[model samples]
Target: MDAANLDRLVDTDRVHRSVYTDPAIFELEMERIWGRAWIFVGHESQVAEAGQYFATTIGRQPVMMTRDEAGGLHVLFNRCAHKGARLVGEGAGRADKAIRCCYHGWRFGLDGRLLSIPMADGYDGTRFGKGCPEADVQPLSRAESYRGFVFASLAAEGPGLVAWLGGAASSIDNMVDRAPGGDLEVTGGVLRFEHDSNWKFFVENLNDLMHPMVVHQSSSLTARDVAKAELGPEATMPPALQIIAPFTESYRFFDEMGLHAFEWGHGYSGGKTSIHAKYSDVPEYNAAMEAAYGPERVAEIFAVNRHNTVFYPSATIKGPIQTMRIVKPLAVDRTVIESWTFRLKGAPDELLRRSILYCNLINSSANLVGPDDQEAYRRQQQGLRAEGAEWVAMHRDLGREEDLGEGHLYAKGSSDLAFRNQFRAWKRYMAGVA
Candidate 1:
């Protein structure tokens, strides 16, 4: 696409519907954006031992995260050097000493070096010699960890992980600090769910401050009613109510707090009220955090409430409950969401349970709040196939952005700055500029 056409395709506020519906644009996104960005992998705690490993995908490439004998982490492609069969199956497993491909008995070390192959004498003098670099399993271009979470970049060049993360790094730091030991563990099993819409729909929705109250009205209202019934008419807000309260939170509240957009399309809706205050019913969790972080730091940590922080092309970190939802794109219009709940390494067990419960209630496939939003996204993808409208409206607070250094901007919560910022990064990546 030419510059004029690309400019017309996207605007400052809203993007063209075709950006969401067109298959061609989706292909371009996969090649230019997801191919180069530092996408999130599983947490380090998931594979803590020497032989433990977890299999994941980066862009369209199948990759594995394994812990070597020296207790270091390695992220490598899953294919074997010989015969091209995957060395390990889908899902997490133990590699023991090395990954043995079931197809040809090709053994590879934890770091993906070729260890041995059965019947090796057949090609000793040929190009498939033991010393050939092609015989070793291919490793990713870059692998790095921030705190305990691991991420990998498929391309050899681009911004480093830290530079790419930018503003979103605070979200991860806040999460780790919530734990008494200043660390987190991936304790609960992942909750995988499929959406019938494009992956971008989910990413865009992360910074959508308006939808929670209206789209999730049924659940929010139900929670409100339950809170009232359980505590009586004069009773205050409850923990369960806070769980769904963001939906009913006033637009003014969002507008004042605003959203912050960073480089590479990463953005987050900021200015969240403390959910802990509403949770007088759950004194156990409050006390646990307070005891772990002490009264001052605990208050500070809880006070930095954020709705959802986007990690660009792949994941959303929900800090309040220590929940992370990783996006795996299956197709232009289909995506798989893997939800992982974390435990504060030194916190109480009840706190961990609370995080799991929130995951089930809000992020799970069976959630009452989630289906409504998914239905809207499905219809959006279907409706955008029309020929009438050429542009999507993102005109909210256009000239009102407060510029932060290093290509970051901030605007009111009601502004479309997040969407606008995303398309800017999208254009840069698609044009091979960033």
Candidate 2:
């Protein structure tokens, strides 16, 4: 699509249906947006040991992150240098010795340096020489880690990870601080789920606070009812129920909580308190945090609670609860979501257990919460296929977003400002502006 056509796909209040349903536009998004953006790859803890590797993708580029024998981290294309076959398998494992291609036995090091080729004496006189750059697996343009979270950008010429993260970087800080050692690791494996809708739909929903009450009403109320029945309808609601029950929060509560839109399409919602503050705190975990960071700093950290923070085009992080969900867009109508829970290093075991419970209850495929939103996304995808509807509305409090200076905007929680902010970032990316 041309620049003019891409520009017309999004407007101030709504976006054209083609952005979600058009195969051609999806390809462009993979190229222009995902290609250049600092896409979340995997956590450093996943590849903590030397020779360990985690395979993932940026846009359509099949890539993998590997830690070498010397403790260096490298993100390289997964394809083999010889015959274009994928070198490593698509998962995390120890690839420390050397990556030997299943096809033709071509060998490469953890850093993707070509190590050996069978019958090498036969190719000595050919154009494929020993030092040829094409003989080695290709690496991505840039790879960087913030705390333990690793990210890579396919485009070389862009802002560094810190510059790219901007205000959204604080979300990472909050997540790490939850651990007494101020660190974390992805534990308990990941729950992979797919959405039969546009990837943008999933990302936009991260900070779209207005949809929970409507779309998630069924599951939320059921969870609340179950908690009431079990807890005698008088006890404080359990944390597991609190996670799902909040979907039925009043409009006034959400509106007062506030939505923050940050640069490069990153933002967050429901920042009034930590996601767990509603139920109660884990005493052991609280004591650990106080000991590590002292009373004032711990209180300050706890005060900056945000429910959902969007690192646009890739992942949504719930820092306070220590869980994250990443969107991997496979096709125009298909998207895969990988939900992960973290163990805050040095914190109590109960804290980690709570995070795991939250992940299983709300983020997992069989959860009571995810299905409700998934149903809406699937139905919306099917419905948008009709020729009748030409646009998707994002007009809630459209003109009321308050300027918060420094490329940030404050919108009432019920506002669709997050979607508008994302589309504006989308337009910039599609136009190759940054």
Candidate 3:
């Protein structure tokens, strides 16, 4: 498509439905957007010990994350240089010192260096034995880690990981800082779910403040009712369930907190509230935070209640419950969500329990709230396949976003500034620029 046509395909207020439904566009996005962007791999804690490895994908390419003998992480393509067989199978496991290919007995070091190939005499006189770098596993163009989360880019050039994270960086910091030891570790196994809708739908849903009350009404109401029955005299106006219930509160509540959108299509919305004060269900957590960070700092940490922070095309970090949902787009209408929960290392057990409960209740594949949202996304994809509608509305707060420095935009929480800022970055990346 031409630049002008692509430009017209997306507007400040609405986007053509083809952006979500077109197979060709999805393929282009996999190359232009996912290839160049710094995509989040598994956490560093997953491969904490030397020789531990986790296999994952960056864009369409299968890659593996391994720890070198020198205590550094390396991300390399999973395919073997000889015979083109995948060196490791499709899961996380230890290479036990060297990665041995099951197909041909070719062995490689933890750092993707070619070590041996069983029959050394076959090519001793040829160019194969002189230690060619080409014979080793190929490495990603860029690999970096922030705090313990690892990310890799398939393309050779782009913004650094920190620069790409932008405003969403604070969400991660807050998540780790809330822990008593100021460190976080991935404890719970990831919950993977398949969605029969475009990945963009999930991305848009992350900062969508309007749908929660309506989409999550059943769960929110149930939570409120349960809380009321359990604590007769403790019910408040904006109950704890309201936070998870999606749309329990009016737009005015979300609007007051303000939203910030950053350069790389990442954004955050929703008001800040204290979970410890709201529920009072985890006193041990509150006590640990207070002991480690003092009462004021603990209060400050819990008070920064963000709903969902989007990390562009890949990840969503929910601060309140310390939940992260990473998106892996498979096709035009297929996406896989890998949900992980973190425990604050050295914190009280109750804190970890709370995180686990939140993950189960809301973020899990079998959650009441997620299925409802998934149904909506499914119907949206079906509807978009029709011939009637051509564009999706993003007109909520058009032209209202204030320009912050370094390509950042900010507005009230209820504004659609996040969507607009996202498209701004999307257009730039899709056009193959910064």
Clashing pairs in model 2, backbone N/Cα/C closer than 3 A: none
For residues 1-434, what per-residue lDDT tens digits would candidate 1 score against the true structure? 65666667765666787778778878878887888888898899989898888998987789999998999898999898888888787678898898888988888889787888788899877988476889988889999999988999888998888889997898898888878777889975788889888998888887877676688778787788777788897876554566776566677866766798898889877745533224443466567777776789877887787768898889889786789999998887888988889998767787787787788888898876778888888988787787887667778778899998777788888888887787888878877777
Candidates 1 and 3 compared by TM-score, better number: 1
Give the lDDT of residue 117 in candidate 2. 85
Count backbone overlaps in model 1: 5
Instruction: Judging by lDDT, tell me the better candidate of 2 and 3.
Output: 2
Q: Which of the numbered candidates is closest to the native, going by highest lDDT?
A: 2
> For candidate 3, lDDT tens digit of each residue in 269-289?
754642223544467777777
- lDDT to native, each model: 0.81, 0.87, 0.81
How close is every model to the real structure, measured as TM-score? 0.94, 0.97, 0.93
What is the alpha-carbon lDDT for the whole of candidate 2? 0.87
Residue pairs with clashing backbones, model 1: 13-394, 14-393, 14-394, 213-247, 258-413
Those runs of model 3 whose alpha carbons end farther than 4 Å from true positions after fitting are: 226-247, 274-277, 294-296
